[model samples]
Target: MKVSDLDVPELLDVITKAISPVIFKGIDQDSSPHLWRERMKLHAEIVGRITAVLHCGDEVGPDIGEIIEICTRNMRAGYEQSFSEVLGPGGSLSKIRKP
Candidate 1:
């Protein structure tokens, strides 16, 4: 499915469901709204790009197994800083600072 086809809530649900088992491992319950929103936006962008490549029959992109791995890797890396910031001491959202 195209990532744009899913709304914010649906996207969040998909992400949460996909990573549910791993959430408790390190996710911060106090995650900030801004960071969470950015993470989700990044996730959707990546998903959409990957989907477009797959639909074009790109060899590497057409592989579901590899696609999932790429998506997960990209998302994890993209959110690492945000996740760490939220989960860090003093319950800070420092990672959301302006560029």
Candidate 2:
């Protein structure tokens, strides 16, 4: 069955779960606008693609990891740009937290 066969709310819930980590931050949103903007952009991209995949139903057989990888790739580029803006010339990666 096509994803469109599902109700709107169900479709949204599936999409939300797929993109949960990106959209579900708490106080971070209140404190960090720049980071939040990049995150939201990634969230939107992931959700949009996931939604399309779902809408395509069995034809494409999309995987969540594929969606995440795409989001991460785009997000990384956005983050690099955001870091450049915030850190300034030769600001160094010291400000970024080490994982």
Candidate 3:
């Protein structure tokens, strides 16, 4: 079934479980907001594919959390490294005057 067919609670549970690890990895580890945004975008893409796979297959073997965990664990194996540099670590954009 499509995400539209899911109840609100089911959708929330699926989305939350899919993205929770990314939040923890980004927030608690001091990862940049840019990286977090990319992670969220990747999550939406992967989850959509996985959900479609489930819909097409007759398998009901895994819970949503388990499936998400498997997908993320595998995806991370091929993730490329990228860095985000903050121009002013703690300063507002308006406060950073060009020299």
Candidate 4:
């Protein structure tokens, strides 16, 4: 479906789903601190670009900022959950090592 066809809430869901998997996959596959840092930088740039586009669009307008915030929070929560699952209790990205 076209992005234009989606409402604000639907757009948030679509964006989160589309982006979160890539981040989770990166977290899972990154074998070194440098790789992980680079991947995260790229991800941040992508998300920033997307947010800028959404903010400029007449359809999203003023609500875009809040939507982006919520989307980011959801993505962070998903990352933390994935890390916890893979690393067990008290697990965090800092504890991840090449394996």
Residue-level lDDT of model 1, residues 7-88, one tens digit each, is: 6555555755675444333335455655565555556455545543443342444466666666656656666656656545
What TM-score would you give candidate 3 relative to the actual structure?
0.36
* Residues forming the 10-long window of minimal summed lDDT in candidate 3: 79-88
Candidate lDDT (C-alpha), each = 0.53, 0.58, 0.51, 0.57
Each model's TM-score, in the order given?
Answer: 0.35, 0.43, 0.36, 0.43
| Ranking of predictions according to TM-score | 2, 4, 3, 1
Candidate 1 has its poorest 10 consecutive residues by lDDT at: 52-61
What is candidate 4's lDDT per residue for 1-99, written digit by digit as tens?
A: 655554755665587579867874845543554555555555655665475555454555666666766655554555445544635544454465565
Question: What tens digits encode model 2's per-residue C-alpha lDDT throughout 1-99?
Answer: 655566755876776676666464662413454565555566656665665565555566546567656655665566567656645544443255455
Q: What is the lDDT for 5 in model 4? A: 51
Tell me the spans in candidate 4 whose CA falls farther than 4 Å from its real position: 1-10, 23-30, 59-91, 96-99
Comparison by TM-score, 2 against 4, better one: 2
Prediction 4 TM-score vs. true? 0.43
**What lDDT score goes with residue 58 in model 1?**
24
Q: Please identify which of the two predictions, 3 or 4, would achieve the higher lDDT against the true structure.
A: 4
Q: Which candidate is the best by TM-score?
A: 2
Q: What would you estimate as the lDDT of candidate 3?
A: 0.51
On lDDT, the candidate that comes out on top is 2
Q: Give Cα distance to truth, residue 1, candidate 1, Å.
A: 12
